[model samples]
Target: MTRRSCPCGLPETYEACCGRFHSGAAAAPTAERLMRSRYCAFVKGDAAYLLRTWHPRTRPATLEPDPGTRWTGLEILDTRDGSAFHSTGTVEFRASYRGGSLHERSRFERVDGAWVYVDGDFLS
Candidate 1:
């Protein structure tokens, strides 16, 4: 498969964008970055990174990336401030895939100075 632009909405290539976080080269600096990396993880099937970055309180023991889907694009809708350093955040986005489309409003939390994805609500 030919590598394509990141579905996370970053201008950089996947390898240079969220790939850094997936490869353990860096930590996501903000809730938006964490959200982007998680999206990239889905695109690349980087389950380990997804598991690692997910907030333990809400994370599942395992994930099965849907093989039938081919993700085509992402559009971020909104982001807003949340709680304290250990706080809450939100990311609303739309993702298009071969099978269908998804609109989600994901919730996030900061724990131990790192932003971690907690959960999301499917809006579409």
Candidate 2:
């Protein structure tokens, strides 16, 4: 049997991995998990979930993903805190797309017991 892979490059199927977060069935437990899910959201163009998981302080009123951008892969480079025991952290990752790629150091923080993406620094 061939198992479907998640866009985040995880061995688990989308349903078993990032789908739960996309569907709002669960919340990401750590910075890396939240980062992976956000990458998956970009792949799926699930802007609603993306906004919902964004920190209210930084979330835009609307998100319009570029139609031409096709996300191809994600490589997590590093992480700090943002665990169950910590309230804030950062995730540095490289996400590839059709024409080019994006390297970002994303920030996250737990608000009201749920992880939310706060912001990111675009890296070259």
Candidate 3:
């Protein structure tokens, strides 16, 4: 059987990497893992997973992945305090698309023992 590499840029197959989290078989153990899975969700256009991982206070009523955007790659630039011992963290990343890239520092928080995206600051 053919194996699909994870869009999150991990060495493991999708099923072993972000897919595990996406399928509810396991939860991301750390903030960086959650960030990677969220990136994978965006690439796969999995709005349900995205919404499920979004902080309740910041989560929108609904979400729709942009079909027009073609995601190419992800680069994790920096991270702060997103560890198992920390309740909040920030991830700085650059997500590349077809024509351009998005640079942002995203904030995350542990909600009910699961990491959830809170918000982000766009960077120049």
Give lDDT tens digits, candidate 2, residues 1-124: 9988999988999999999999989988898999999999989989998999999999999998776789989999999998999999999999999878899999999989999999999998
Q: How close is candidate 2 to the true structure, as a TM-score?
A: 0.96
Backbone clashes in model 2, listed as residue pairs: none
Model 2 worst lDDT window (10 residues): 64-73
Looking at model 1, report the run of 10 residues with the lowest lDDT sum. Answer: 79-88
Error of 1 at 83 (Å): 10
* Per-model TM-score versus the true fold: 0.88, 0.96, 0.96
For lDDT, the strongest prediction is 3
Question: What's the C-alpha lDDT at position 59 in model 2?
Answer: 95
Q: lDDT tens digits, residues 33-118, model 1? A: 88888888888888899999899999998998986678887888898764345378998888888878899999988888778999
> After superposing candidate 1, which stretches have Cα over 4 Å from the reference?
1-4, 82-86
- Residue 95's C-alpha lDDT in candidate 3? 91
